[model samples]
Target: MRLATFVAFLAISTTASPVEKRADAFGIDISSHQGSNIKWSTLKSHGISFAYVKATEGRNYVNPYFKNHYDGAKKAGLLHGPFHFARPSASSGSAQASYFISHGGSWSADGHTLPGALDLEGGCAGLTKSAMVSWIKSFSSQYHSSEKRYPVLYITTNWWKSCTGNSAAFGSSHPLWLASWASSMGPLPAGWRSAAIWQYSKETGSTPGDQDRVSGGSAALKKLALGH
Candidate 1:
């Protein structure tokens, strides 16, 4: 289906309602690594406002569940975005970018859904710090432009310090989506001054899948996705 029509369908289905008094808002992230079938309808009905669906990993292979969750997220009227799982084995970041494009260039389009993300965590597996940062730069540079904003760099505090200690590598311009998973949004890591989204916990909700707890609500996430 056309992207415009798909988005319009989402808008119509996502009729805003009176904000119910609640203690907090929630979001979910699905990926191939976490093998579980998601009931998008159930999530939506249960007040899920946003979701991050894994798109691709390494230089080959898109997430098998990507399209399913992508369409499901749209159908559920959730603010949606795609994230790439950075592979330490990959030769270059541009190679990873090429892989991502081949998997889903829809993310490259301006003003569409949420900004793409780079899932940067875990051990180097073999790559050096310079190689890892080079990959990051290549990936970021691919989408870096006045017209096209670079994807948010998704990283844990320790991972950032170990992999890319240089804050200036990403500069101050790119939006950061830090994964702290702390009790509260306390003092962030050395390089990170602010975060667009704070992934607070892996244990959340009365749902089945391993979900991530976030600080913002549906409205806040929707604003981020639509750039409003």
Candidate 2:
């Protein structure tokens, strides 16, 4: 992630401060470090209707705040989704996805929780670009087999180009949460015509983490939240 790109991300996003007004259904994502005192009501009062909390990383690492954040977000009346950071080299995607599910990514028919997500950023866990694509496929396959719904894929252009060769295999089936700070989504990896959620900001003191916008507004957001 280039500094310039990250800066643009902060600018494009409306920011997490409740003072900023946004018409779309924008949300925030956080990990254990956000602390347990996050005022979820304050976010909801500001128009944040949903959130994605980090659950697990690789396979063994679990977010210390996942349970709290998840339950707290729900208590605040905000839709919640749990995300897992992918570490293809640490373990097979199948194993990692299963582990994530076992920990906190489990899907339910409840409309408040979205399907699990795979955050496939950062350096490839030591695999070739082609091998990285294979890793995602394996992970997605395992996740879908168990949940009956495709877990959302969150990624950036540089990582995708360098790791997966920008494979289009999962585009049509999996909804994408594209990470780009540019004014445009730029060129999406092959297959995906558009992104479902655009992570427009990475620097925002108001939210304590990254913030994003759901492409289809609140209605579409409801569908994703319901895992439809």
Candidate 3:
């Protein structure tokens, strides 16, 4: 009877296991798929410091909510930036880079513009790992030359291993935004020494979106936003 009671008590316990929350800063990443229900001020009130809004993807697809989210973040006093989802084999790197920059990838020294990110996981469509790396390199290079800053790489260990050869080749120049559901940051990418941000969960606050923790607090993150 005691054993059964113990199990029941454990199941009903409101307290939870420990989770990693030692973040310099916390924020979310959103796209048109998440809709426009986000109230930036309310989120700010809840201590949401920044956000990354989906801009362009592939060669031509733009996030329909890009402008509103960007504006909303500003209106709500949240620092924000744009992200482009990669379709490695669908288009040439420079071509896609052009599309993304033209849409919203351009960064200004303004306080709200965090470094843009290249979301790299995708259906490769037969693109070889070597070719895919080259593609991403070309895109990031072009973005750097044009905007004077390299975009962050958002990726996972498994995807990086299979699709990117798990090499830390880009780590020196491009910071990483690693995604993991574990209670901690877990292992970073093979080449990257540390992550710029860790996407720790897919749910947070009153909004349904990916949650993240910036490595260096709000100051470092804000510097990236200002293109410093």
lDDT (Cα, tens digit) per residue for candidate 1, span 67-145:
8888888777776788888886755777676677667533533333777778887776576778777778888787553
Per-prediction TM-score: 0.76, 0.87, 0.85
Q: Report, for every candidate in turn, its global Cα lDDT versus the true structure.
A: 0.65, 0.81, 0.78
In model 3, what lDDT does residue 220 have?
74
Question: For residues 1-228, could you state the per-residue lDDT of candidate 3 as single tens digits?
Answer: 122332233233212321222336778788886676666775665556788999998887988889988999988888888999988778888888889999998888777778789998755557778887888899998899899889989998888888867776898878789998777877777878888888876654432457777867777787667655
Looking at candidate 1, what is the lDDT of residue 30?
73
Give Cα distance to truth, residue 27, candidate 1, Å: 1.2
Candidate 3 residue pairs in backbone clash: 113-225, 114-225, 168-191
Instruction: Predict model 3's lDDT versus the native.
Output: 0.78
lDDT of 2 by residue, 71-157 (tens): 989999998899999888788999999999999998887787888999988877689878888888899899999988899999997
Ranking by TM-score: 2, 3, 1
List the candidate 3 regions with Cα displacement exceeding 4 Å. Answer: 1-23, 203-207
**Highest-scoring model, TM-score:** 2
